[model samples]
Target chain A: MPLTINNYADGILHGVSFEVQRGENLIILGANGVGKTTLAKVLCGLLPSDAVNIGGMIPSQTYSEERAKRINYIPAKMEVFDSYLSVAEFLSLSHFNQTISIDEALSKLNILHLKTHSCQTLSSGESQLVLTASALLHSAVYTLFDEPTANLDPTRMKMLFELLKNDTTLPSKIIITHNLDLAYRLGFDVLYLKEGRVAFHGSSEAFFDQTHLDALYGSSVQKVNNHVVVAL
Target chain B: MKKLLLLTSLLLLAAAPFFGQIDLPLDKLLQSGTMEHQVFFELRLPRVLLAFLVGGILSLGGLVFQVVFRNPMSTPFTLGVASGATLFTAIAIIAGFSTFSPLFAFLGAMLTVIVLFAIAARFQNYDPTALLLVGIALSFFYSAALMVAFYLSTLQESYEIMRFTMGSLDVVGFNNIWLLGMVSGLLLGLVYHYRKAFQALLTSYEFAFLQGIHVKKLSYTLLFGVSVAVGVAVSMTGPIGFVGLIIPHILKTLYRVSADKLLWQSFFYGGIFLVLSDLIARNLGESDLPIGVVTSFVGAPFFIYLLLQRKS
Candidate 1:
C-alpha cells in the first residue's frame, strides 16, 4: 500500500492529503517556515496522528517492527546524545539489511575513515554523510530525507544525487530540500508547499516550466540551460 | 592510566574496612574472642558493604537517568524520587512511626513514580524537559512538606530527621547488607537487559523510535526499576547525594566510553567512590561526620577539575 495522509491537520499545516506509492520517489519543496519538517515528522509517526496511514496501518498506532520497516525520517542534522558513540556504533543501531554491512555503507558514503570517529565530533558535512550511511543501512521501505544536501559540498552532493536517483535499498525517498537545482535534476514528481498548503503537486516537467518557476520564485530564480538557477 | 586507576580503586577498597574511628587490630580480631572481631564483622564490614551497594545503585541510577533523560545533569535523585523518600521518612519520624520509616519511604518513592508517569501519559508527545520540570516542581513541593514536618516535630524528632537527611552508613548486621546486595543485583540486571535500547536512545529520541524501539515504554520501565531500587537505597541510607550525580560522569571521563559500555563500570566505581568517601567520613574526625558532606566536599572539586580538563 502507498504511504497515505488524508486530511491531516497539524497546527502548522492543515487539510493535508497525499499518497506516495512504492518505488515512486517524491520531492517536497516549500519556502522557509512552511512546515516541511513538521509534515515529515507527522508522516514518520514521530508526532502521532490518526490522519496518516501506510500499508493499511496508522503509523503512530502500529508499534511493531513492521511499522519501523515501513518508514524512516532522516532529519536535517544528526543528533546524538552520547559523546563517545562512534559513527560505526551509531550506524549499527540502524543496520537492518544483513547484506550491506556498516563498513559497506560507510564506504559507499566515502566515510569509512570516519567509522571510528565519535559521532559528536564529526563536522556538519561529515555528519551529513554519516546520516546518509545510516539511511542506506536502515533499508526501510519509505525513507524521508530532510535537506540531505544542506551541508554537503559539490562532490558529496553529487554522490548523494546518484544514490537518490538510483539506489534500490530504500524503495521510496521523499526528499525535502531548498536546492532548486538539485530538485530539478532529480526529476521526481514535486509537491510544493506554501504557507502550510500544497501549492503545487505535479510532474517535474510541469512544475519546472518557465512560467511556473517565474510564478513561484519570481525574479529571484531563472531557467538557464534547462538548469534552475538564481538570477544573481 | 586505566591500569593505574583500577589499581588505586582496588587498593582503596582493600584499605577501607581497616581505617575507621575505632580501629580493629587485625591480631586481636584474628583471635576471635575480642570486641575487635565483633566490631570488624558486625559494624565495620556491614557498614562498608552497605555504602558500596548504595553507591552502586545510585551511580547506575545516575547513568540511566542521564541517558534516558538526555540531560547530563539528570540523576536518579533529580526527579524527586529521593526527595519523596526523604519527606516520607521525616513524616514517619515526626508521626512517631519511626519503625515503619522504610515502608513509608518506599511508598513515597513509588507514589512519585506513579505521579510522574500519570503526567507523562497526558502529553501527546514525549518531552523530557517538561517531565524534568514536573520533577523539579515535585521536589519543591516535597521540600515544603518536609518543612511542615519539621515545624510540627519535637526537638528530638527534628534532630532525628536531620540526621537521616545528612545520610549515614551505620548498619549493625549482615542481614540488611544482603538485602541491599540483592537490590543492587536487580538494578544491574534490569539495566543490562535494556543496555542496547539505551544505546539506541543515546541518539535522538526520533532516531531511536525509527529503530523500532518502544522508546516510551522502555524508558518508563527503566525509570520505574531505577526509582524502586533508589527508593530502597534512600530508605536505608537517607538520600546520599552526588554519588549518583558524579560517579557516572567520573567513569565516563576516565573510560572515555559510551554509557552503555560503562554500565557495570559505573556501578563498580560508584561503589568504590562511596567506600572511599565513607572511609574519609569515618577517620577524619572524632565523631563520625555525615557521609553526604564528605561526598560533596570530595566529589565537587574533583568533578570540577575533570570538567576543566575536558574543556581545555
Candidate 2:
C-alpha cells in the first residue's frame, strides 16, 4: 500500500507498505511513532491515517478486512474483564460455538491453572498472556499482536512464536514487536518501518543480522549479547 | 425459549387479582360478573398491568444508558434525564397543562439527552467521563429549574408536584398499558437488532467499531429508544426508579453478563421487580406511597451494599 503525507502529516502514517501471504508470519519492526502500530490499526479496519490514501491492496498488504474477518488482534489495550467474570466466566460468555472454552484456551497457552482466577487477581504478565490466548481463542484467519511478548520471559516468547508460525489451521500472523529475538524466531516475512516509511522489507534472516538492524534503528540501537535493543 | 415461554405462561396464569386481599372468586364472579369483580377488573388489574409495563420500560431504558455510557452507575437520575423530565412535568402541571404533562415530560428528557450528547460531542475525543460530567451538569440545570418552581409554588401545588416527582404506581382511571405494550414490543426488536453493537461495547468503543458497529448510529438509536421508553414510563407513572437501575444489574449477575443475554433477561427481571415492588409498595401502607419512594428506599441501601460488596 502507498502511504503519503498531507494535512494531518503528524497523523499521516509514513514509511509503510507490504503484502503478507497466506499461512505466513510477518513481523513489523520499528521504533516508537514510526507507524508500525498505525499500519496494524488500518488493517484492523480502524480508519486509516487521517491523511488517508493509504494506498491499495497488499497482494502484499498483510492486513485487510478479508484477512480481518479471520483476524484476532491482541491489542496491548486490553486488561482483564472484571465485571463479575472469572476467567471461566469470560470464556463461556465469549464462546460463540466457533471458539474453544476458557480452560481449553488456557491449556493451549499453558495457563489452564488460571481457570478460576479473576483478572484483577492475576499478575500483569499472567493477565497479558491470558488475554492473548483469549483473544486468539476465536482464531480468525489472522492474528495480530502489538508488542505481545512485552513482559513474558524468553520461554513464553518462544512458545508464542511456535504457535504463530506453526499453526496449521490458523491464518497468517503479523506480530509487531520491539523484541528482536521473538521477531527473528517467528518470521516468514519482515517489514521494518522508520519514521512511518518502510525502511526494509525482506526475510527474517536478512533483517535480523546486527548491521541492518543497527542501521534502521540508528544510534539508539544496541546489541547486548544476541539480543537487539531499541533504547527507549 | 421454553424458559421465556414458561415465564410468560406463569405470569398470565397468576395475574394480579388472585394474590391480593381483593380476591375475585373466579367461579362466582364469572357466573354473575359481580360489582366487586367488575371494580377489581376496572381498577386493580389495570394498576398491576401498568406496574409491569412501566417497570419493563424503565428497566429497558436504564439498560440503554448503562450500555451507551459503559458505566454501571448511570441511569435516568445519574444521567439527569429523569430529573429533567420531572422538572418538565412539574412545570407543566403548575401551568395547568394536565393532559399534556406526559408529552412535556418526555420532550424534557429527550431534549436533555440530545443536549448532553451535543456537549459531549464537542470534546476533541470521545470519553465516557466527559459524557458523565456533561450529563450531571445538564441534570443539575434542569433540576434547578424544578427547584425554583417548587419554591414559588402554593402549598397544595407543592404537595401534588412532590407526589408526582416522587413517582407512584397508584395510577387510576388511566393506564398506558396499550401504548406500553406496543412500545415494549418495538423496543425489544430494536434491542435485538443492535445486539452485536451492545456486545462490542462490552470491550471498548474502538474494538466495537472494529466489529462493524457504526458508533454514531448505535449510540443515537439506543439513546432514542431509551428516551421513548423511559419517557412513556415517567409520563404514565411519574419517575419510578431502581426497577430500571438495579434489575438489569441483578439480571446480569444472575446470568453470564454477556450484553446479548443481559438485554433480554433485563426485560424479564424488570417486570418481576416492578410487579413485586408495586405489590409491596401499595400494600405495605393503608394508602399506597409512590413506587419511586419505595424503589429509592429499597434501592439506595441495596446499591450501597453492592458497592461495599464490590469493595470487599
Candidate 3:
C-alpha cells in the first residue's frame, strides 16, 4: 500500500481505511462539493485550512518533508507563471538538477512539436499537455492528476491510462475524475463518494452488473445489450 | 554574471562625472581636483548612487512582495507598509518631529505591516486578495492621517511635508552614502540567501511544502525584507513612489520569467533606470527637481499603457 490513514475520524472519510497497491489507478467519483477533491488535496498535501475538520493527523505531523515529495498534484486551476521563458524554461526551473529535455518529454507525450512554444501562448489544451510533460519530467513518484480527462482528447485519455500502466517501477497514482465513462478504460479501482463519504471501494466490473450499477449511482439502471445506462 | 554587470555599471557611473554642460578633462580634473568634479561628486554623484542603490533595493523588495502575494498589483504601498513609513515621515516634517526619525519610520512601517498581517491572519486561509483589500484600506487610513497632519501644520512646514511626500534625493556628503551602502549590502545578502525560498513562494504552498520549504518562515522572511527595503527607501528618499511599484511590474511583464529570474533582473534594471532618471532629474533643467516627479511623470503614463495592454 502506498497510502495508509490512521485514526481518521473525520465526517465523510471518517475511520476510512483503504490501501492502494503500487501502479494502481484509482478514480474518485462524486458530484461537485463532495469530499472527492478534498480527499485528493489532503492526500497530495494541498489540503485546505480547516483540514482538521475532516480529521486525521495534521500535515506537519502526519508527513515529513521527504515523504511530501511522494505526491505531485495538478490543481484545479494551474498556476500560470508569466515570464519570457518558454515551457521548457519553466520545467527546467522546477526542482531538478538534470532535467529532461523538452523534446524528450514532448515526444513521450507524442507532442514533440510543442517543444519551442511559449507556455503563455498555448491554448488550454496544449498548456495542459505541457503541465503533463512537466509532471513526468523527473519520473515523479505517485503522480496525482486532478481530472486528467478534462480538456483531453479521447486518444489522450487512452494514452494516459497506458502511461500509468507502463511504469513497471510501481508508482501509485490517484486520478480525481467524475467521468464514469472513462472508468472502464482508465480506472483500476473506483472510490465512490456520496455526500463526503467513500461509499464503495470496488472494480469497474461492478458498473456492468445491473444491480450493482444501480446501487453504484444509487439509482435504477437498464442494461441494453452489453451497455448499462443509469437513469440518475 | 552579476559581477560583469556591476563592472559595466561602475565604468558608466565614473564616466558620468566627466560628461555635462561644463565638461572637465580627465588629466586636468585629476591633477587640480576641479570645482566641477567636486560638485559632480558632492552634488551629483552621491545622489545618483543612492538613487541606484535604493532603486535596486526597492525593486527587489517589490518583486518579492508581488510574488509572495501572487498578485500583480501587490507592492509595499499596496500592502500599506509604505503608508507606515510615510506617516512617520509626515509627523517628522509637520509636527516638529525630529528629522532623525528614520528609525521611527522603520518602526512605523513594520508596525503597520504587522497590524495588517495580524488582521489577515484571521482569514488564516492566506486569502491574499482579501489581505490585499485590507492593505488598501490601511493605506487610505494612513494617507488620511497624513492630510490631516498637513491641515494642522504651518505653511512652511506644510510645503516641506508636501515636497518630502513626493520624494527627494538631494542629500550631500559621505555619511548618508555609507549608511545606504551598509543597508543595501545587508538587504541584498538576505535576498540572495533566500533565493530558493523566493522560488518556492511563486508556487503553491503544497508544492513548496513538498519541496521542503517552511512557508511560514518564508512568509516572515519576505515581510522582513520588504519592510527593510521600503522603510529605508522611504526614509532616505521620502516615499519615492513609483520605483518600487513600476520597476518590478514592468520587469516581470517584460521578462515573462519565474520569480527567481525576475527578482534579480528587477534589481539590476531598477538600479540602472533610477540612476539614469536621477541624473536627468538633477540636470534636466536650470534647477534640480525631486526624483519622484521624473519617475511618476514617466511611470504613471507607462503604467496606464500597461493596463490598456492588459485590457485588450
| Candidate closest to the true structure, highest TM-score | 1
Say which candidate scores most in lDDT. Answer: 1
Compute the lDDT of residue A171 as modeled in candidate 3. Answer: 62
Best by DockQ: 1
Using lDDT, rank the candidates from best to worst.
1, 3, 2
lDDT by residue for model 1 over B1-312, one digit each (tens)?
988888998888877888887877779987776999988888888988898899999999999999999999999998899899989999888888999988898888889988988998998777878888999999999999999999999999999999988999988899888888998999999999988888998998989999888898998899889998998899888889999899989888888888899988889899999999999999888888999999999999999999999999
DockQ list for all candidates: 0.78, 0.23, 0.36
DockQ of 1: 0.78
For each candidate, what TM-score against the reference? 0.97, 0.80, 0.85
lDDT of 3 by residue, A172-216 (tens): 667777656556555468877776566778887774466877665
Cα RMSD over interface residues, candidate 1: 1.0
TM-score of chain A of each: 0.97, 0.74, 0.76
Order of candidate numbers by TM-score, starting with the best = 1, 3, 2
Query: How many angstroms is residue A37 displaced in model 3 relative to the true structure, after the best TM-score fit?
Result: 0.9
Question: On residues B1-312, what C-alpha lDDT tens digit does candidate 3 reach at each position?
Answer: 556766876776666545545666666555547786676667666877787778887777777777777676666677777787878777876656656566667777878878976886677554666877888898899989988988888888787777777777776876778887887778777878888667656655665655546676677677666776677777777777777778887765665566677766777777876786677776678776777888888789998899788679
Tens-place lDDT digits, model 1, residues A129-196: 89988889988899999999999999999999988888888889999999999999999999999888
Q: lDDT of each prediction vs. the true structure?
A: 0.90, 0.67, 0.68
Per-candidate chain B TM: 0.97, 0.87, 0.85
